[model samples]
Target: MVSFTASAQYGKQKKADTLFNKFSFVKAAEVYKELIENKYNEDYAVRRLADCYALLRDVKNAAKYYKKAVKQDNVPIEYYYNYAQALRGVEDYKGSREWMRRYKDSGGVTSTKNFGKDGNFITSIFNAKQQYFLSKVNFNSKLSDFGAYEHNGKVYFASTRDEGVSVKRLYGWNEQPFLDVYVTEKGSKDPVDHKAKLKGDVNSIYHDGPVAITKDGTTMYFTRNDFFKNVQEKDKKGINNIKIYRATLKDSVWTDVEDLPINNSEYTTQHPALSSDGKKLYFASDRPGGFGGSDIYAVDINEDGSLGTPENLGDVINTPGAEGMPFINNEGTLFFSSDGHVGLGMLDIFATVADKDNKIIDVINLGVPVNSSKDDFSFFMGEDGLTGYIASNRSGGMGDDDIYAYNRVPLLNVEGVVTDAINKKPIANAIITLLDGNNRQIAYMETDEEGYYEINIDRDVDYNITASQKKYEDDSESFTTKNIETKVTTITKNLELNPVQDVVILAELNTIYFDFDKHNIRPDAALELDKIVNLMLNEYPGMVIRIESHTDSRGDLTYNDKLSIDRANSTYEYLISKGIDPARITEHQGFGERRLTNGCDGSVNCEESNHQLNRRTEFIVIKMK
Candidate 1:
């Protein structure tokens, strides 16, 4: 018979081995549960049980076990990190944050710099405004494929599935094969079940991927590389020397494949796209003078369809790592893929505004549903700016990369009215211009018959607006907007018409003209003052007015005073000829330019633009009653 002590030790050893062998974490957890419940090997059992729960995706239970294990035994810092992840998975964000804080305070190691900001992946994904899965793409295969373009209600992308004619073995993997390009029509239910190969002579034994099609669908641009051939040639950088090529659709087939001149030997250029108007081309390049590894660049398309010098887009859109595959809609909203920007996975798609002058504005991360803890990029939006496509390697897709369509809501709109300041009537045919804080014109729209105009503006752009008409003075106003999503904004401003006084007319300083060294009113100035005489006779039959003139400090004081008086009398004579009674008109006075509007004393050092401020004409309210 066996000894009781030997049998008890044997039983314990068998139990631990069984927990390690089952690999069925759920069952292993149950076995560990019994050990902990009976106070047998409590520390080991609790830690094992927590790891099992985490593998099972039971985050709440996982956290529970982890807390118990840490209390019983001092576990490694990684255990606490795992516990924080579990808390976050269970939507206990505050708890997760606190746990992370504690871990950091206890001197835990971190892979990245300071915690995520508002633009970071975890924050943006959780705070996304809209998100959904692209129903028909398969994401499990090992091919490196992405970059989708939407044109004329169809989606196109690069893939390396069984349908590819060319197969090249990949290194560092179990001899994985090459990839190719594929196209899918809109409203299709099954993507893989009904795949269509891109029609072209360009598909060779090499890899052909990452396509961008023009709005008219007549032109196509994509990347091509011969990794196998380059490897054989022993070219150190051959495997990554991808080049961009263009093809035209003629007779329903892509032909005449040609290399773009913009592709230089200095760097690899790929993922080319054409603007909506076909006037400019945008693409990704890792050439020298870029902000970092790779950045989106653009060039003007010549009349003969050749490219001009390419210009780097700068730090606004490009980061320190990689920025590629840019897609721009008709409204100038730019969509691109970046591994450099903060994201939830290997790569994520982002968006920003590509202004008319090619300035980048308002970079925004596309949050969850559209982006996950997987590779997602190559986005294309429709002309309507709301519906479009994306290429992702998420689960349940048709192949290594698949295309998806998304529906988006329209952004905010701004509307305002411009009117005559004096009459408060709608001003017709006024030129309304909208400028940003930098004084650059963002958009310009003309007022309709009712003097109302509307513009679709992004959420947070500061604006300065102005309206001008031929016969009236210009009116301007400035306002800054909040970052919140506002549905509509309305502003009303009245533009004042020029002077219309009676005997001695007064106008805004800018309207009246003065002689070269004298404040005496010129003949041309009298013609403008006549409008005031006409208004007095028609609106106030018995109204009288005094004309006032001012002179600069250029001449003797007495002579300057005399010149101002002569100018005012010249205005009075002109008003009387226009049927204004001399008896009803008051005499004139000269201020000799003593009181200037601007805070500058009459000095030679004052600039011409400022000196103009001192020369003016005015009429006071002497008899309003």
Candidate 2:
């Protein structure tokens, strides 16, 4: 016969475990509380109940039970680790660190290494709980046999289920059906099941499945081959070279299927991407001189629509394994799918920064939830950068390679304008920037000709806007915005220009015209001198102003210099006689037979009007105070 106390304890323990197994963690915790209330197997029940609460994300109760379990002794290292992780999840970083240290001190080790071989710490500080997966876009069987790309509120993909003139052929032994390019809007209730076929020479006898549409949805680049036309020929090696072709949209129809020059007679080139500006072309090539099997290459698009010679993107982007399907986001971040790279799945999506010089840097593997053990490739990121679409063959998908959507945290959008303060005139090409309080540049852009600029900024940060130009003092303004909101602000400011000072005021000696070179101011010259007196009284009422005179290149340099000085002195005396203070006027210097506005060698180009530019009297603002 069972002892009464032992049987009662056994019954309570069984009830707690049963509730825990059902995922009713709160109920299980209550049962554990009742057992502990009676002091029946208190330690075991408490620890088990802590694990149940932790599974339910009740970290506070989990920590309490874990402490109780440790006090009772025989508490495993996993219990402490779980408790520490729970504390960290609750943002108790300091306490969590202490517990983790204690757990390690108790002869415990983390199962995975914290640092990568590159010596960089790999743990994500961002809470994974804050991330979410959006709804999966299910493509029915009629539309499932295609690859899709979204642009301008439309999804462009390729399909060939008796919707075209030519019968499509299966490319490989896996017997995947060949396809032709098609397009449909985003919010169609019917899964594009019976949409009209895309018009153009988009389909051929061979496979033309994979496609990439430019941001404007006007241009398209797709992969196809001429193999089927020459199938009866003997030599087979040259027939399988799949090449990419470009098409233009004209009059609501795609015309001019032109083969890109980057395609060579020796190897295959496919999966082309045109930059947003349509100036750079990125594509995958299996030609020789590559780093590995297939490498990404880029070519400059000339203004006349011809392509320059292609250059390989080096080993940073390409690896020993094939690095294909290169897609560049609007912010110039590069996303591609590779099988040779180490990742969570067979073929995973990787991201890297594409620098201005077209070099790849800081390659990162997109971790779990985006990548599974199955093949996941053909990724496309939206213009917003926070939403992404990827094609996958993972189980539970709607088709062989279904599309999945996920939320991506976007780089913030910082936009503003620059204008003249007084006139309110729009200043074009004005450089504007947003900097942190520490003066680090967070975002920057130059205003367009219309005096407008928009830049994407990271969220939850403060920044100062700095605007500057030639002949203007730098302007710095500060602003902040809530996360995920488009901020519109304006900066209207005036640039006060400093006047030039210490400039010489020059009078033409020819205007003093004496009787065949006399050294005195003539009557007509005295009238011009009176004009100077009036100008001095009006502009520089109290300042000391200097007068200087100059002669043409005809007279002797020394004699004409003295004549010029006498004429200047005569003019200064007249100004002093006109009730102007003698202290406010000064003696003049002369430059004779030199510093002529025109070259002295007498050419038709040296006209008198040209000399007028040099003959003018100039005034400088000396001291206002």
Candidate 3:
């Protein structure tokens, strides 16, 4: 009947602090708000309440509290960090950057992490063919929802939905209805809206979800409250921790549920991601000795359906920030979300490929469409790879966290190493050229120190990759990227550039064509000649190039000889003008109609390509002084 604040009951302030310490943030916010309204410990109350909102990922409310507390003294540097993250989510770039600057100035935090890498990674990701963008789920509710995994044609995930049952009520953590695992009905009009089955045994009146279903659909690995098995464990802060659990479906109902061996009540272990074969289990934990708040870990599944010891994914995949929601694709590539690595803001999704030895390899941030300034996590890719699902709290979402369908248009990871064919060692600094099926230049990059080069390619396209070095023979490979069933995404274009032999062909230019009955160099012909000029003047200065020009057998032999001579002289003069010494050209001879490459020597009806092949010029190393 009356308004009461902490000033009216200062004795309860310690109780509020205790509740906050227990990570019961929603309830703590209420107490802190009361204290602030009554002018009791207003500064700390406003700041602490704001921290709770930020931790809960309520960006707008966090921003509100930050605006009030930013001017206060003795505020933690993370407050500035949270302020920046929250500002960016609300489209306040200038404010966010300024707050980022303050966070840097006020004892800037650095933990062996590349803070700007994620933002830069986004650039290249978008520059490559765009493939992943969020599509709002049709059945997203106004409550928190996330972590959708597809199994048996239905998607199983976690959600906070209302069921109008009192005993199945609120969780003090977010003040939402107890989180439960839900699944979409494959035959339903809208699967996301379908009530999930196997709830009672597998789910508790506490948080449950983001499950990993085995290939057989008989076993499940999921996360739920630690109290599910009467093991009510809490951290030093008194907040109940989460544990990973495994269960089996008996008679179409999940009957047996048990916690994994690696789960600890003292910290937290949640977000289960399993390999497609169910042999590898990846999850997030906040246990000590981690790089930061939470780190991604992996455990091998034994042949007997038990877990191996947990292994940290190391510094590459796990940073000093939170990393969760690991999803391993069909090819064993690991996809997870991290806040430790520098990203657009908050948590961003990243991927790491697995080597043949089944060890995790290079981690890459999946920039732009999959990541935003707002928190984006809970990524699941279907077997087809063309479509998947991700969970995010970015702007324009249906709820606190909504599941969005991600459709990848056509993208693939193309990688290879340039090695000397003779030595079998990686070639460093080899120039690599990428061309599409139409022979149009796509992109170029040099090999790294280890002779490794990787690039993103649009799928369903035939690509030609040419690798060249000054002293090595140019090598090229034709790559056809088939979408959907593209397990060969990481194409090993392991090019072997053999050293030039005595009779060297420096530039293997494709059919250098001339215009009909013409001797002058066309644009395509000039481009090819330029490459020869470069080889002669810049690369092979000591070699003498004999430019031999030929024409189709369509004209008189004498006239053809004269026209071919003109063509040879035109190419020679162009090379000379481009700084290739006249001495380098030992001879510019015209072969006329005598050297027709094919039987289409005016004796048979042939297509233009055959005729063009005959109307060609080539440079050969005749003498190497």
**Candidates in descending lDDT order:** 3, 1, 2
List model 1 lDDT by residue over 530-619, tens digit each: 656665665544445666777666667788778767766666677777888776667677777576667556454676666655565666
Q: Higher lDDT: candidate 1 or 3?
A: 3
The full ranking of all candidates by TM-score, starting with the best, is 3, 1, 2
Question: Against the hidden reference, what TM-scores do the models get?
Answer: 0.48, 0.46, 0.68
Residue 334, candidate 1: alpha-carbon lDDT: 76
Clashing pairs counted in every model: 6, 5, 0
lDDT tens per residue, model 2, 490-539: 22332222212223432322244443355566677676667657645653
Off by over 4 Å in 3: 1-12, 22-24, 91-108, 116-128, 164-168, 190-195, 228-238, 353-362, 410-625
Best by lDDT: 3
**lDDT tens string, model 3, 509-615?**
34467876998889988888877776665555555668889898888999999988988888888888998778767899899988888898776799987888888
Candidate that scores best on TM-score: 3
